[model samples]
Target: MLVEIPIIQKMVLYFGNPSLTFSIILFSILLSSGLGSLISGNKYVKRFTDNSYYYLLFTAITILIIGFSLNKIIEITNDYVMMQKMVIGFLIILPMGILMGIPFPTGISKLKNIYKEEDILPLMWGANGIFSVIGSLLAVALSIKFGFNSTIYIGAMIYLFLLFYIGVFL
Candidate 1:
């Protein structure tokens, strides 16, 4: 929600419309994340999951980098055509999309290792869906109230808090 709103807004500013840019952003994220989810079962990804702390740390850092760099990237690409801007947006989001894909399956996989239970995966996904809906609403409200940049900062802070939560509890 946080990241999507700002990126969409920026894309609108660049391209003068929402439909194509939104489709590109949404599809790019979905496709890349689906790829990430599929790759999560790979041996290397499993090895990375073993050190989930560092994985999440890198995720946080990458998100922060994206949040900070997105505006600058838009500025740099200002003269490019709409198609080029779309591609740039996709490339900008692809890494984070892949990283965002990791947590759920990896979390469920880790839990399976410890709990010998199958039901938890569905429960985890359900909880994620609920929070995602709520988070999207909240992100729009925050964006309207505080502006997009602030919303992105708040999103980064939320990720930082998650990092702290993982450090303390996971």
Candidate 2:
């Protein structure tokens, strides 16, 4: 999903400075997500944690919003300067990336509390890797066939489904 954003931006947004836009997007996502992960452990931030449910929910909703509205966003801001456009893109991606970051650590903490005797961390890590690989491949294929917007919608649906699954099971 992170990997595909630059491609989609380049292909769809047609920013005047494509390279700069790509760099902005990549940097924004990485930095924002890192901040989110870092804050997840903070004492103040912990008070706001709702077992990671809101994080996943926000992430899903944000992705879906982006999927449905990004092109229109670009259109509305088409007259802005290239730097302004890049900044807008970065700001828009920030929340979604940050929300994306919180869930993993929260889940890990939850699992640790629930399964102290068994070492399920390795299994969770493996599952994370496998699903990430599958998701990356699926994102590429879906973006190729249906374009980036639809691919994002599918990703959001997957996130929502995962949220539902976890809500039911764990």
Candidate 3:
């Protein structure tokens, strides 16, 4: 996402305002993910919350679909006004962002139960932060060398791998 923003601006929305495009994408992700986080905590969705592997699977598929069809999607929407484009972009990002949000809190909750030690939660959070920083840097390099589509595909693969881990280890 960090890597794809500029690429999207360059390739898909070259004529649009860069700042608006950036903000639309960024805020769409934040808003959708925050909504997802709120949803994941709901008692009504206990069944869904118990099975976060499905969330990861959905996220992987959504990302892969986006990576493959982004060009077509943009081409189809090219004639729309900026506001329409913003909606299109938000819709495109919403599912994956929402799915992405579910896993972290779910994972943390699971870890808390598994490891009763209070310090482990903080350690896990710190590790998550460190990995996020590392992943962002790696994403930049991957996007630079392999292009955004490949980078996105790699991300999808990581989600798939996490699904496997959750199935076996979580």
Candidate with the greatest TM-score versus the true structure: 1
Q: For residues 1-170, write the lDDT of model 1, one tens digit per residue.
A: 67667767767787667787788889888987887898898999878867867787777787788888888998888999877887888898889889888776787777788779556777777888998898888888998898887887787777778778978997
- Can you give the lDDT of residue 155 in candidate 1? 75
lDDT of 2 by residue, 1-170 (tens): 63345244543454666676667777887888888888889886676676556656777888887767777877788898877877887877788778777767877998999999999999999999998787777777877788777777777887788789889998
Which stretches of candidate 3 lie above 4 Å from their native place? 1-15, 167-170
Point out where model 2 deviates above 4 Å. 2-12, 16-18, 43-48, 117-123
**TM-score per candidate, in order?**
0.89, 0.79, 0.85
lDDT of 1 at 77: 86
Worst 10 residues of 2 by lDDT: 2-11
Query: Who is ahead in lDDT, 1 or 3?
Result: 1
Worst 10 residues of 1 by lDDT: 1-10
**Global lDDT of each candidate:** 0.80, 0.75, 0.75
Error of 2 at 156 (Å): 1.1
Q: What's model 2's lDDT at 17?
A: 66
User: Using lDDT as the measure, which candidate wins?
Assistant: 1
lDDT for 167 in candidate 2 is 93
